[model samples]
Target chain A: MTTLLTDPATTGAHRADTTHPSVSPADAVRQTMTMAWRATLKMRRNGEQFFDVTIQPILFTAMFAFIFGGAIAGDVGSYLPLMIPGILAQTTLTACMATGVQLREDMDKGVFDRFKSLPIARIAPLAGPMVADLLRYGIAATLTFLMGLLMGYRPGGGVLGVIAGAVLAMIAGWSLAWVFAWVGTIGRSAQGVQGISMMIMFPLTFLSNAFVPVETLPGWLAAFVQVNPVSHVVSAIRDLANTGTLTAEVGWALAACAIVVAIFAPLSVAAFRRRM
Target chain B: MYAVTTSPTPPTTSAVRTEGLVKAFGGRRAVDGIDLEVFPGEIFGVLGPNGAGKTTVLRMLATLLAIDEGRAEIFGVDVRERPHVVRQLIGLTGQYASVDENLTATENLVLFGRLQGLRRADARGTAARLLDRFGLGDAASRPISQFSGGMRRRLDLAASLITRPPLIFLDEPTTGLDPRTRGQMWDTIRELVDDGATVLLTTQYLDEADQLADRIAVIDAGRKVAEGTPDELKSSVGDSSLHLLLADPTQLAAAAETVRRQLGGEPVLTPERGRITVPLERADRAADVLTALRTAGISLSSMSVQKPSLDEVFLALTGHDTHSETQETAA
Candidate 1:
């Protein structure tokens, strides 16, 4: 306490107006990767965070296929192609939803306060967990396909188609996670984010051609199913995984994913900045 | 001027300067119209009760919270204008331990370094040195959730020092520690100043400010009541006083008489019939009062020797206690 006045090094140590610059684009990317590394570390410590991507994928795939196959398609074998891709889309959405809920929980922790006090890019903390979440989406997509294979369902698209379908679905899932991330930023609590996510997700997944085809619905219902981004994605997955065709549906799915990212990415960043 | 890439130029004599700083939550201003100036290389203390807005002031200066309706500058750079540059100049240890609970102590420190642009190997080296310095070497690999409160606080402080900015903000840095750990924390804070970092700390304990601060600002209800050396603040309030409770309410007058005989000033009576507060010139005078009360046939229930409470200090300095209904503004 006494030495502070005598010591010039400790007190008034500011030098020539350095005015260190804010983070650059390159530094923003680097900082995001570091935040991603932190998310992976958190995942390792709390393995339960993976439950939705793992157990839910297998459970929903098997339960939906066995129960709806015979009645909707006239035979379980015939239902495989349609059901598998739909399950893939559904499970991926579930995985993406967890991204927002977990983000809400993570933000409430004391460490996030420290992150705010640092000079890192504002979007790093929000996007880092989404980047690490690519694995969760991958797991959910693969398990849905594997479970289909074990149930004696074969895709005409074969190995290339399945891999391509999985990759496309994962990309869609990652982009769509921005919606949940935005919710996480705006929602008051983790449970609140989950509730709003479920409200949004259940309708998108259920009202689409995920479990049932579009033709079976009323005219107005079918029209909505035609435009619901989830249907485009499912149709795209079906083309890639069931027929090995990269058709217009695939393009539509990619365009939808791009638009979601373009809109919701900025929304998430803006809300996150306000929180800090 | 914004493009000039120098170190914000050595702050103009003041390490920290804030004018009319305010932070509002909805309708209430947590910190309202407060001004502060802290010289470089000094340990300046903000002394106040729990709601005195000490942390709010620190957070605004540290750039952790927005400064509403006022100007805050670190060195000479305006906080509102260049928060990033201000962040580069200051380190803040929040009241709660802000280290990651999911990470090991070493990993937490390294992660903080990496976030600040340190290379991996350099971060690891710094982590090892800090872990050893804070006496957490043995538990460096242990998860933070397993650490004791004192250990967690130490690790939190270590994380803040990883970059070692020239100015530090410590918000109630030792609120809940055993006496021994508290003493060690005070020593560590002194060491930081000796190494040449200007520190602005907020504390509820007057003794902590007396021990660590070169100057003190007494705050209450988001306002600075007094600013001076510790001796000046203590002198205005007399000194640390004595609080004694009698075993029998009937003995209160006799104990009061004994206190008056042993110490010159009239003892203050409390609402409680058996308790009285005796201000002291020196702490040793407490022993004289205690001995006189016992010899005067006054039985004691409990006794404490301490600095005037926030209430006591407020009464002495502003002629009013802190409770809202008891407030006598005109007086």
Candidate 2:
């Protein structure tokens, strides 16, 4: 087998492991991880905002704490507990955009089409990009907590709540990737993906009471914020880190996670299947 | 993983068979209803001009695209019903280079090997051997983006070979390659065929089709126009061609008319080039032509009788030159 680089998909010998004569889910996961790892290693050379993964979350958390802390809540110290969770949600959500932008770039360069021809699982291409986005999520989550600590934002719920908050943010980032994957596949160009994704996400993030209390807004806007999934996620994290309590908002936020996975996971898989 | 299962084994017959396969995009039929059979182990060439649906046919056979209508079977397993099985038995390299540009040439091969479910050590070993076999061992560590077009193409082909399938589909594999690279690729193909792999290659280059194909199918307007061995197709056009180069430009028409009157058939003449061409069943007509031309006292620059080329056969069957833009538009 070493004498020539025969396509493994061609050999019937490998068919035993494939799921029912097609590509297996396990095989697809491995391929995606390999692709993600390759893309991850590339950051070592190209050096395009690798630090931003960690730096942006920290900067945003600190900057938002100082800017909005004193004016709205009377002092930075009093608002640090409240503002930290909101800042974490906002920064992690914003970091999700990178997945869409990178996917668009790869598609533009004909990289996805190459994946389509391989006999691996249909979902590997999505897996690779989605998995690669996790590192960004991890970096963002870590730096946010570090900066919150430096600025005197203590978690009332202790280390467990802090860990729970980070894990929640990471899971959200992973689930959100499916939505970006759908957008990247459907958009015509990488630039188009960035433009469309920004348009959709900007209002979702801004209108959902990330920076201020919903009670301060008009009656209709407050009602909208109450139902916003981002609001539930942020409030849940706030409950965990600030009050040391697992509130109903945490249940709603976990349900929202389930909903996002249900809707976007199939959407991403279907869109990918249609494309190949 | 064990190969033995309680289920009955699949029946093996023709390596690839298609019946009335049809595919349409946006109300335009790319591959009209066509039937083709590619037996195992021989190199089959699908010869056509641009937009003749050769690639579409190959794609359907490779299980990349679904058949809009009709049935396709690989090794007697229906493509739609058992596409994964078909994929397991065949290798496909599309028209463009499809390797990961960020990875080294060896990395690209190894990635595909792992995707094919090879163990890490085996995939790496296979990748190294393929890199050496394709003469890219020294360039193995360099990123694929740094490789030249020919080098990238070789790597793409090498990736497809990472698993030795019984059948291979190559869609215009040599289209943009230089003459030397194209020849090298042909040699590689010949070697694979000799090792008992069936290859179905689509090419517009008549010389390539002539050189490698055991049998050729000429498709026009998404249908097979002619199917035969290269020699058979050429011979079907006629025995030989009598080409005349006239000394005096004005005498070409006169010479053609004189030959037609004596031979009872019209001879094609080009007054601009002062040339005349006629088809002859026997070579003895060359002597008769000289006698007639001598009696007429028409001067001749050159004259010769030669066997027909695939280009001539394409012209004779299609009524237009294969290289002409109109033929491409027609398809």
Point to the candidate with the largest TM-score: 1
Question: B1-331 in candidate 2: lDDT tens per residue?
Answer: 3232434334335677889999887787788998888877778999888877897888778766778999997766688886666666777777777777777887888778877777789889988988888889999999987897778777877887777777778888898899999899899999888776788999987678889999999886688889989877767777687889999988876798777876666788888999988877777877888888989999899999877665676788888766662233211
lDDT for A98 in candidate 2 is: 71
* Per-model i-RMS: 6.5, 5.4
**Model 1 lDDT tens row, A16-35:** 14434677787778888888
Candidate 2, residue B198: Cα displacement in angstroms equals 1.1
lDDT of 2 by residue, A37-153 (tens): 766766555666356567677777778878888887899988887777777777777777778777777765534545666666777777776787777777777788889889887
- What would the TM-scores of all predictions be? 0.88, 0.84
lDDT of each: 0.84, 0.76
Docking class of 2: acceptable
| Model 2 misplaced regions, further than 4 Å | A1-25, A42-45, A49-55, A108-111, A150-152, A157-160, A243-248, B2-12, B238-314, B320-331
